[model samples]
Target chain A: MFSRRLAFFLVSLIALLLAVVAPAAAQESVTLDFYFPEATANNAQGIFEEYAAQFSEAHPNITINVVYQGSYTDNRTIIQTQTAAGEGPDVAVMLSTDLLSFIEAGTVVPVQQFVDSTEGGADYVADFFDAFLLNSVDENGQLWSIPFQRSTPILYYNADLFSEAGIEAAPANRDELVAAATALTAEGRSGLWFPSEGFPIWLFTAFQIAGGEPLVAERFDQVFFNTTATAEGLQYLLDLSKVHQVMPEGALSWGDGPTIFASGQAAMLVHTTGSLTRILSEAPFEVGTAFLPFGPAGEDGTGYGAPTGGGNLYIFANSSPEEQAAAWEWVQFLSSPEIQADWTARTGYIAARESAWATDTLTALVAEKPQYAVARDQLAFAGKEFTAFRSIDIQNVINTTLSSVIAGDVTDIPAALEAAQAQIDSLLAE
Target chain B: MQAALPVTNRSVSPARKPWSQRLLPYLMIAPTFLIVFLFTLKPAVSAVIDSTLKPARLAQDPPAFVGLQNYADLFNPTHHLGARFGGILLNTVLFAFGTVAIGMPLALGFALLINRRLPLRGVWRFGFVYPSLLPLIGAASIWAFIYADQVGLLAAILRAANPNWLGSPGLVLGAVIVVNVWSQTGYYMLLFLAGLQGIPRDLYEAAALDGANYWQQLLRLTLPLLRRTTLFVLTVSFTFAFQAVELLQGLTEGGPGDRSNLILYFIYQNIGERRNWGHINAITIILAVIVLVFTLSSFLFFERGGRESER
Candidate 1:
């Protein structure tokens, strides 16, 4: 009996020893906090979980804790506050607009050096879609952040309304658009609705680019929004309400143009291409996508697709070198063509990397649904987040001005535009 | 302050003074004072100091020393101060006075109605006070759903009448104020009811002997005796109504275009939405001063009236 007990004890001791040493023998695992800017309890978390699972399976060397920090504003504030307190996360996915500020604050470390240190880093050449790649680079010519989820502006319209109105498909020019909108506005529906408060920047950019006029002064240091071109653009939207009387009474206050369009209250809306997937999945009626309409005089103009607006993975300067290396590896894994395709399939974001389209998964997706090709085709015109305007206040000033016009509180387009410019210029000087 | 420490009366015997006896009072009270000092007084003192300085950060990127420039900027009338923030201040005052003005009378009336023999009086009192027990967020959420433009309870009511309540700016503030009144009236009614029950029955009997009518007896006996209660209700209701951000934020977020930007909501937007800490801090100080002056003046006026009446 004594011999039997001794054998059992010996067996148990060996099992315990193996259990304790197995983890210790492996390479040490690093814990990383990944701040997700657009994440909610909704679809964003599941997408991140898939990536995290794949990454952890491949590399037991690292662990990333995904934390949703509310909206862009909330995430930015939390990051700013934490960085000030010297406790920022190892990796943060923040808005492209915050790129300049992050660089200026010295909160993020440039990953260019890491690439150079690697064996085939030079071969990688740090490629990105022309606009996004350039935008990710700081003034000192150092790459600080990388594009992840990118979206371009597209005109979303109700096909049911268009066909019923006998509108010849979707309008491709300014005059065509005005006529189409007028024709579509009958009975219970308005012709077109724009989210003036939520995304005025995109609508304004699209029109300004098509009109062949500068939206702001060079260096973004001065504002010229009151110029004839912009005034005409502002007047174009306002005319729908004041002159055409084809728009809703409260479009100025609307933040969700999707709901408005889906409800069939508005026949047309200009929103991000990212919205395409949601509409296709959720809409009760047929939906259509088209390149934005252009100005009357300005033809042969390349459609302006602004650099996709979403967060990018960034390594904070406060992280240890080892942790930074691990974070970079995680970013690279996420940026891989297969992962990129997976991300696009799951989330409706266009692939940030050019090579992602060549993957078999993306090819299969494109073959299955031809509309995905429109987003890919528009990549050629994607413009970077205008580096000259390094401040978010510029957009705020412009949006407020546009909202005022929409509200009918400011009727004189030129005067209102001038007021917006003055406000922005003053903010810049401060 | 230093000399005030050793003021215990000599009538106390030393033999009765155990260490615990000497220390218990201080020990029990220390925690409350410490918490109050740490959370309230310290922050207040810091805010005052911070307010006097220009809205500046310190260190390698210290805020620019504009000394009093922020305050100067706030009071500048030629600028868009009124359009920017004055509306909020005015709206706050309107909301405060309007809620109390409507609420106190309704609460008192309900209390009086139920004070008499009525069916299921206990159940009625419990039902009236139930809403006050709910947290502001919980209450506001329900009300927000009720006032929802699309499928809300109030919207359904309006749809039965007419389907245009949510889209109109004219009715939007009214909708919010109504919710505020509903959530708060019950709590104040309970207070008034307690005060009414505490009044000596003899006063009413004596008035009855004098052939006073119900209104006359109420005026002579009930109201005069309920002065302190009235004051408490007014001040407390005004504070709660003035700080009604949950309902405002949950229901409207001060939108349909800043039409409902009450002072607290406006402050929250400036800080949370705009991220202009300087403006937020400046607004905070201004609001504190406004609240201080208004309450103090009310106290002084009421106190003076009381003294004059005695004379």
Candidate 2:
């Protein structure tokens, strides 16, 4: 009886061991953790999970652990803290504007190596917009983060408000924009209201870029805010507040302009093209989209240029080569034309791949809604803002200063800009 | 024969031994020490080390060990860190003081009113204390909607008289102070009432016989005896006011152009919004020191006052 029991126990233990180790042996899967700031509400979440599942099913050798690390700020915090502790996510999705510092800090690996390892490394849309690819590259010319989800600033107007004001079409140029905004402003309505802090930096940076001002040269370590175009951009928003009275009071307090616009309070809002899907769902009135109003010269005049607002995938140096390969494969999979089209359709973000828009899926979607193409159309006009040491905070301070000026708290344009420049310089110095 | 047994043969069964006789006490407390060391002490020690460095983010910039430079920069009036500390600290202190000043008396009043013979006192007490049980974020969100600028409930109500309740600089502090008081008053009042009940009725009777009026008795007898309880309430309330972030964050975000800005909110904005952890850590260390000093001073003052009163 004892012999029989021993044999039975051995058999059961062997079976249990097989049960535990069989899957790992069969698949040889590497567990990859991909971190993105995109929250659960963004359709990007669903697309990522689906892509992960698909990749796993196809390779049968990889498992991607997708984590929604909260907002962009939260993601940065988590990455910074974790990386400091010598542990960070294997894959991180970061904004292009924020990646330069990360690269400088060596927190990210250059995707160029992986791309080179693959076939046709140069084919990965090396030039995003005219100057954007250069802006995205680190000082070493290493592409630290690929632009997976890119967007530009666009104007979202209430079609119902336009109809009520007897306006037929959205303004294409600065004069037309002012006239439209002035006409739209009445007793209970404001002509245009961008979020106080939300897209002001994007709007102003675009204005500067369009006005032919070098915000930050590639080699320069600081922003050039002393230019006439920079001053003009600052004054334009301030005038919207004091001179035109077209912007709302307490705009400095506005966090998200779309919500205000959707609530039928703001007639027109300048926000990211990324907000289109969410706005479409929430807007009570008909929504119309157009490129941001051009500056003084009209359409050919200083036009709207925007910095990219979206996350790019980056592989961490801490990750194993196998894990890196798996991550890169996953990134390429997502960036492919098929997946990019799916992503664009599901989420409001414009695909970073220029070729993705020409796909049948995107073409069909765009045919149904031509407004979705604005971000892509404005790619030529948009360029990233000058990001240097303490750039993020410097930008925020500058934006706040502009916001203050627009809110009529600071009236002198050059003085406020000078103060902002000095503040940024001091921050950079410290 | 049993008495003559070898000494080595004698043994105490582990299960039969009493808990006091075993090393189980240390075993029981070991987990707590492990947790405290791992979670609290380590992070704090690291933050202190981090505070002495030049301000930068990204883990690779080896924190330059500039001893006391960050601290000096923090106290320097021209710097943003120093400027933020100056303004935000004042707001934080005012917020804490205002919350406690208004909340304590109101709580005590409610407690006293409820302690008396009144219908549905239990229900009223429950209703009063209910808000304290709610999460700070949810409560703040509700208040935020009510205080919304353009079409807020309060704004709509006051629109007839210029609509200046929440948005105006003069009224913004009052608005937040009201919310803070509302959230905390009930819990403190409940504590005060408990302290009041714990006092022997004979003391009040003796005071009454000594010709002490109700107000005098309250000041002389009630307050003096409830000093310990008052100190506790003040400490907890002050800490709550200092630490409460969700309410301020959700409600105003330290804005309408820095009117409602507080130190904790400033720290959060610096760290989270700006990703400037060095500056964040620097500010944190300063705030920690300030809070420590204030707490120690308050405790010392209270202890000295109590001792003097006894003398």
Candidate 3:
């Protein structure tokens, strides 16, 4: 009645704006491939599926395709193979130490971009434990990954054995560890199975950190393998068998430790938190957990050092921006305190987030089984794992050198490390 | 040789075959040719070329043409992979010779023992073949448990000695070889059994009628008569032994220091750990050459044996 033509034109302009904005809101459902290393957690496939289902229900526009890769090594192989062919998984949980390899290969996208863009993103990144986050960032402090299923090596001592041997408590220092092991060694069983064969390098690096210095720091190309740390670490392991006679002389597979401990063949085991659940369930005797015994208190306050191990969530470079966005949302949801609490409780992985400790799920779990809290408390002393450029090759050098000396094939530990350090330096020079 | 065939035939012939017939042979061999070319020849050639080239430190960068640099690394005394090349060669020779040399004779011995009429012969045949019937990996696992450090069946039986079977560098290779022989004897026994049945009975009868004893007949007739089967079995077994990988993978992992590290197992280990494909491919080329030499020599030796038997 006032101005019919003018009103019609205004309505037409509004209709045109609606057409532009509608499609932005209505996104096509993105299906993301999430590669998970199955061996890291118990029933990881089922747990991943449940989490994916929860995310899908919340978003309803993104579908997460959970894929179980065989092991951490297998995941690396698959990722490298697929990414070369340009069809890698949109998201994956690879070894935290695998960051350099993946980054150097240009196959991954830094989660830092998302961290910078999101509201209260700094606070979000700040929530994870410092020890776990050490392996997640680069030299420039560029965040390439997020800590999820984290682990550290801890001492699993047999309480019954302690009582039988008249030991006061779990060993807390090098001298005490030797004494307890000596006391526990008996007619049939050794006191401790310090695993150095199947899984040689990880636990050995813990010894290195406690002995004096870390094998490597943030720089991938840098390594310190010929120091007092390396010598003392290998010497300790060698003496455990050669001098103390508390363990066997030959290389014992780390995989066999649980069975040996459960069958009361080993009075104590130095293994990862990942095996805690299985050892706890399988042992007939009451299994008590404690922090690892520290080595020679060094100038830099190197005592009680354990490696922060297990996998981390990484967003790959090959994904579309839309898929990356969706994967980030999924990653955030997976690493949230609630989910992390449940994950820590269900699996033996240490909760990477400080907030997860306060959650009801984890608090209840720790209250029921105090063994669940040992690794968390030990996190105060835990340091970064032995990671470098070409990690596997360098690790093999360290492993074989240690294995050779421990197997009694070589008696000169210092000379062996010197030769190894030379070889490592040559390799890193490449 | 194959490419020369059509040209030589056409040139040396009095008359050419019809077009369809000329094409028939090629058509028949095309699938095999394509398959061999794609799977075997191509990869082999590619490996040879890749052996001369190395990828950049970071994989994304272009590969460098480092001619013979990888080969140099292979011979480098300081390098772990290279330091063990000599030991790997020795281990391979030991595995191949040890398995075939001992296993074949045991197989023939068992076959002769069973070739005569025995009670429940079928059951005995199945019993002897049972170990080989188990999958290679499965059989290796069984032996692994049997050879475990302590509390194993071997440990339990030999409680007085208390040997570390799979752990000792001095003993691991022999331990692995024992498992290989255990798995192989049954299989070679089956082959010998088939060959034993195929032997003409009249020849043995003729030897027996010559006033010869059982050992005489065995030395003269049985050994000569089974020449072809022996040749086939030995050739196959040596090739099989040279390529042994799964047993090591399951049992010893070529460890306690390269004591059991055969050539093939070393290559397999490198393929997993070594990022440089050039070096890995060089190792592969070396393994392939070893396999080739052993295979060629086995056939040549067996063929000479076949000819000597005729004489």
Best by TM-score: 3
Arrange candidates, best lDDT first: 3, 2, 1
What would the per-residue lDDT of candidate 3 be over residues A50-99, giving only the tens digit for each residue?
99999999999999999998767667777877887799899999889888
Q: Considering every candidate listed, which one attains the maximal DockQ? A: 3
Comparing 2 and 3 on lDDT, the stronger one: 3
- Candidate number with the higher TM-score (1 or 2): 2
Query: What's the best-to-worst order under DockQ?
Result: 3, 2, 1
| Alpha-carbon lDDT, every model | 0.68, 0.73, 0.82
DockQ of every model listed? 0.19, 0.27, 0.31
Show model 2 residue runs off by greater than 4 Å: A1-27, A39-44, A126-135, A252-256, A298-302, A407-415, A426-430, B1-46, B55-62, B77-80, B155-175, B205-214, B272-279
How much of the real interface does each model capture, measured as fnat? 0.01, 0.12, 0.33
Residues A327-406, model 2: lDDT tens digits: 88888877788887877787778877768878999999999988788878877766665576666676656655665565
Would you give me the overall lDDT of model 3?
Answer: 0.82
Cα lDDT tens digits for candidate 3, B96-138: 8888878889989989988999999888888778888888888
Ranking by TM-score: 3, 2, 1
Least well predicted 10-residue stretch by lDDT in candidate 1 chain B:
B54-63
